[model samples]
Target: MCSWMVSSYFGSILYSEMPFNVEIKAKVSNASQLAEKASQLSQSEGTVIHQQDTFFNCSLGRLKLRDLMDGNGQLIFYERPDCGGPKLSNYSISNTPDPEGLRAVLADALGVKGKVKKERRLFLVGQTRVHLDTVEGLGHFMELEVVLKEDQSLEEGEVIARSLMKDLGVREDSLVTGAYMDLLLEAQG
Candidate 1:
């Protein structure tokens, strides 16, 4: 359960007003083992999601259209620092029924940057969302997002994230900075 409102529909678009989370991403060697541990810790089966995130060049922050491949999509704008440890992120999301049209329009307007396609296994543990992602051409990764409450301090969120990392056996050495898109671009160069 995220502290922020999931979405609000205005006209044809559903928006997630403004929310912040403390998060971290890490490289994982054994996704299955991590998934098993995450599932056990969460006490529930995880949901599998196939996502294709197409990024657009934005002057400030990162903008991307996420196509779920199920006829639904999300347009997300987020700003977070590139760091190995947990960091705060501010983000907004809008849901659109027509992703192709939106993607084309955004591409024409902002220019396409890169795309990341991944199969994500999502698990919820308390207020945190644990994502075990198998990214195409990248490899396995795990992300922990501690959705912060409106009144919560950033340090509180980081503490939660760090505890979850320990429980999941995530070592500090395996942490990665930046998004999958950055990794993809670096690989290309």
Candidate 2:
């Protein structure tokens, strides 16, 4: 059964991007060459990233939820097939990473607000095969994403993501993103 719970109070997410998130996948001879290209920018420092999407195993429209760590702004989120709210606002920014213990430290530094909204989501991007997203909660979102390839290490992508999150404005202790089913259930009328 699907239920549209309005969340007694209200839950929201605040996010932004650096520069359109330039997607690049080129063949390089070695790590050195890759490094040269990944960080080669006119006036910006860039990195090579391979997105290991964790949407679903089979189901055409499969999405998931994750807990988020807060940063500058009071927000947390992750990719979902859909999401919703009053939509108070939306924007992007330069992000920073958060280390393993950052969340604990955040408890002392930053403060959280509002109660987390329990929701039921609906992922209506596709039905069968093919990969093209008609995301909800506006065009689409890039929440808790693994940076993929950061600096020369395997887990560097996550590190970079954390850094960007901090530099941008994401809090260290926040629900990364809620279940799409929850969001959709709320909007279903």
TM-score of each: 0.91, 0.25
Candidate 1 lDDT over 58-160, as tens digits, reads 9877999999999999999987767678877778899999999999999999999999999999999999999999999999999999999878987799899
Query: Cα lDDT of model 1 overall?
Result: 0.88
lDDT of 2 at 13: 27
What would the per-residue lDDT of candidate 2 be over residues 64-177, giving only the tens digit for each residue?
212233322221333222222111111233233532243344434543221222221111111101111223441222233332222233234334444433433334443223
Cα error, candidate 1, residue 168 (Å): 0.1
Give the range where candidate 2 is weakest over 10 consecutive residues by summed lDDT.
123-132
Top candidate when judged by TM-score against the true structure: 1
